[model samples]
Target: MDKFSDMTLFVSIVKNQGLAAAGRELGLSPATVTARLQALEDRYSVKLLNRSTRHISLTDAGAMYHQACLEIIDSVQETENLLQTGTKEVRGSLKISAPRDIGKQFISPLISEFADQYPDVVPYLYLNDNLSNLAESGLDIVIRYGELADSNLISRKLASSRRVLCASPDYLARKGTPITPQDLAHHDCLTMVRSNEELKTWHFQDSEQHNVITVVPKRCSDDGEVIRQWALDGAGIALKSILDVQEDIKQQRLVTLLNGYMKNFNASTSATGADLNVIYMSRQYQPKRIRLFVDYLIERFQQL
Candidate 1:
C-alpha cells in the first residue's frame, strides 16, 4: 500500500483543502489522489474524510492521524537533512511574511541579497497588512512592527522606529499647528483604521512628564500609505512611523507638529516607539533553512 506515500498524499490533501489542489501539488491527477485516499481508507477500515464536490472536511480520526503524519514527516525530513548536509550549506525554501509597505521597502531588498548568496534556496515572500498565523500558514518567519500579543511565538527584535506626528507645510500653514495633545481635537487629524471596526487612536505623552492622552481622529483610513499620502497633500495631520515619513520630512514636504506633546507611550499608542521583530513558531526554529534565514535577517538589519 506504500503507507508512507499514502500518508503524504493524505496530509497534502488536507493541507491543500481538496483532492484536485493536492494532486496538482504532488503532480498527480485528482482521480489518482482519490484512489490513493480510498485505498488508504479501505486498508485501515475507516473513513478519513467527508468529501464533497466543493470541499473536503476531516473526520475526528482523520484529524488525529493527520497530526501524527505531520510529526512523522517532520522527523523524516530532519533525519534526511542531518545525514545529507553534514557540512554542506543550508538549502530549502523559506517562507516569510511581513507588512506590505515595510516588506516592499526594507525586507524585499534584504531577501534579494540573501537569495543571491544562497542560490540553492528559494524564498517565498508573502506581503500583507493583515497579521498572519505563522504556524497555520506554514511560514518560516514573520516580521512585525509594534508590540506583539502572541506569547506562544518566539520573537527577536531587529530594529526600532518612533511614531511621529506631522502634517504638510501647507496644512499647518492654513490650519494653524497644534501645541498640545488636547489641541488635536481642533485640528484635522488623519486616523488609520486597521480593521473593519477598529480605528487607530493617536496616543501622546507629556514632553517633560509621564502624563498620557489618547485622541480620536477626525479623518481616517484603512491604509497607512493612504494616510501618509493625504498628509503629504496637506489634508490632515498624521501619526506615522518615522521610517515612512523620514524622506518627506527631510525634503520639507511635511512639518512636525505638537513636538512637545509627541511622547512615547505603549504598544497600542505609545509615542515612545516600536520595535520591528522577526518571529517564528518554536518547533520550526531548529530547521537549517529557518535558522539561516533568521541569521541573515539579523545581519542585514544590523548593517542598516
Candidate 2:
C-alpha cells in the first residue's frame, strides 16, 4: 500500500482496535490488512502497535502518528471540498434526505425537475422519517419538519407547515367526524410511535379555548407513511401534516375534522418538530450544486 493508504489503514486499525475489524470495514481481507500493517511498520522502522490475540493497542509512536494521520486526512478532504468553489461547472453528486411522505409527494418531482436542468449533476435521494446527521451521513441537504437544536448546522425554512386531524370519507361516515378535540377519545385514532414513545397526545387552540387531549391510539406505527395510508384506507382518524395529506383533502379522499376546536401546530411550534426546513452543515463554502438546489427548493416551496 502507498504511504497515505497505509496511514489511513493505521488510523482505522487504531479506531477499530483490531486488524480484522478494520479489514471488515475497509473491505479488505484479514491477511491483506496484516501484510499492509507490517509493510507500514517496516517503512517507519518502528513498532507502531502492540498486538494480542483479540485486540491491538497503539505504541507511543503510533499515537503520535495517528494524530498526524487525522490531520492529513482532514486536510485532504477539505482541499477536495475547496476545489468545488473554483468551478462554475455544476457536476457532482447531490445527496439529499427527506421525510417519506413529503419526499414521495413533493420533493421527488422537484428533484426530477432539477436533474433535468442539470443532467451532469447526479441526484441521490432517500426518503426517511427520522433526522439524519448531515456530516456523519454525508448528506448534502436534509428536508425535514421541526426546529433543529444543533448550532453547527444551518437551517432555512422552506415553507410554513402544520399537522391536521383528518379521516377518510368512509371512516368519517362510519365513525362520524369529530367536532371537538375531546370527541377523538371516542374515535379510533392513528398515532405515531417515535423513539419507543407514542405521540398520542394532540394539541389544539382556538380564539377562546386551548386544549390538550391524549387519545388511546387504536392503530400505532413508527412510519408516517403507514399512518397516512391507514387514514386513507378508512382505518381511523389520523393527525398528519397537511403537507402529507393536502392533495387527499382537496380530492375529498380525506376530510378535515374539528376545524373550530383544533389548531395544529405549525413549523415553528416548540412543542413539536413539524416545520418544513432544509438543513445543511455550516461550511465555509458550499458547492454550487448544493446552493443552486437549496435555492431551487426554496423558490418552489414558496409558490406552494
Candidate 3:
C-alpha cells in the first residue's frame, strides 16, 4: 500500500472517529479500512490506536504520527493545487480574528481591498478584545500586536507597532504634562480594564534600567476605544497603540508625552504577541486565499 494513501486514510478515520464512517467518506468498506490501517501499523511495527468495540483513541506515538501525516497531506494538496492550475488561483473562505481597535482602524479596509482583488475568496472577520483559540474557533488567521509566547502556532512579523502615551492639549493644559513616569500617579490617568482586571501599571525602560510604576486612574474602561476617546476629550492621560492613534497624533489632536522616559512596553494581551503579527497554525500547505491575504497584509502594513 502507498504510505501516503494509508496516512490519508488513517487521518480520515481519526477525523471521522470510526472505520465505518471513514469508509463511507472514502467509499471503502469497513473491512478494507481496517485492513489498510493494519497494514500501516504492521509496516511501522507499532500500534497506532487503542481500539475498543465502540470507540478509538490514538496512542502517544499515534498522536505524533498523526500530526506528521496532517503536515504531509496539506503539503501534497498545496502542491497538487498549484501544479493543476499553473497559476495562483485563490478561492475559498478565510476566517480571521483580530483586536477591535486595529481591526476597525486598519485591517477592515485592507480586507475590503483584498476582497476587491480576490472576489472568489470569501472573508469572515471577527473583531473583539478577547482572544479565541485558532483551532477550536476555526480561524484561518489572527492579526495581533506584541511579543509572542513560544508555541506550536507559526507567527510572522508584519510590522512593529509601538505603544504611545498621550493626552489631549486641553487635558495637559489643565493638569500639566507628566515630567516623568512617576508623575502619572499624581495625574488623573485613564486606565483600560479587561477580564475584570484594572491595568493600572505601566512599565518603562531607561538604558538598561527597568521601571514599573502604578497609577491611580479617575476613569477606567473595558473598551480601549472608550479610553482613547476620553483622552481626546481631555479626561486624562491614556496609553494607546500607535496604529489606533496615528491619525490623531498627526493631526495634533493628541500630544505624545514622556518620550525620553518611555519604554517600548507592549502590554497587549493578544495571543499572537505584542508586535504586529500574522499568526496561523501551519504554513506548510497554506491555501491560496490565506497566502494572498497574508501577503497583502504584510505589504500594506509595510507601507503604513
Extract clashing residue pairs from model 1.
264-271, 264-272, 265-270, 265-271, 265-272, 266-270
TM-score attained by model 3: 0.70
Clashes of each: 6, 3, 7
**Model 2 lDDT per residue over 1-304, tens place:** 5688887888778767788988998999999999998888888899988899986666778756765675566556546656867635667778899988999989999999999999978999988777764443546799988778888789999887777889999998898878778888899989887778888778887767678888889999878899999999999999888889999999999998877644553323353456799998676556678889999999999997
lDDT for every model? 0.75, 0.81, 0.79
lDDT of 2: 0.81
In candidate 3 the C-alpha lDDT for residue 74 amounts to 58
Q: What are the models' TM-scores?
A: 0.74, 0.73, 0.70
lDDT by residue for model 3 (137-162), tens: 44678987666463867888887766
TM-score of 1: 0.74
Candidate 3 has an lDDT of 0.79
**Tens-digit lDDT string for candidate 1 (199-267):** 444556553554444556667766667788899999988887777777889999998776665443342
Which regions of candidate 2 are displaced past 4 Å?
A: 1-87, 261-273
Candidate order by TM-score, decreasing, is 1, 2, 3
Better of 1 and 2 by lDDT: 2
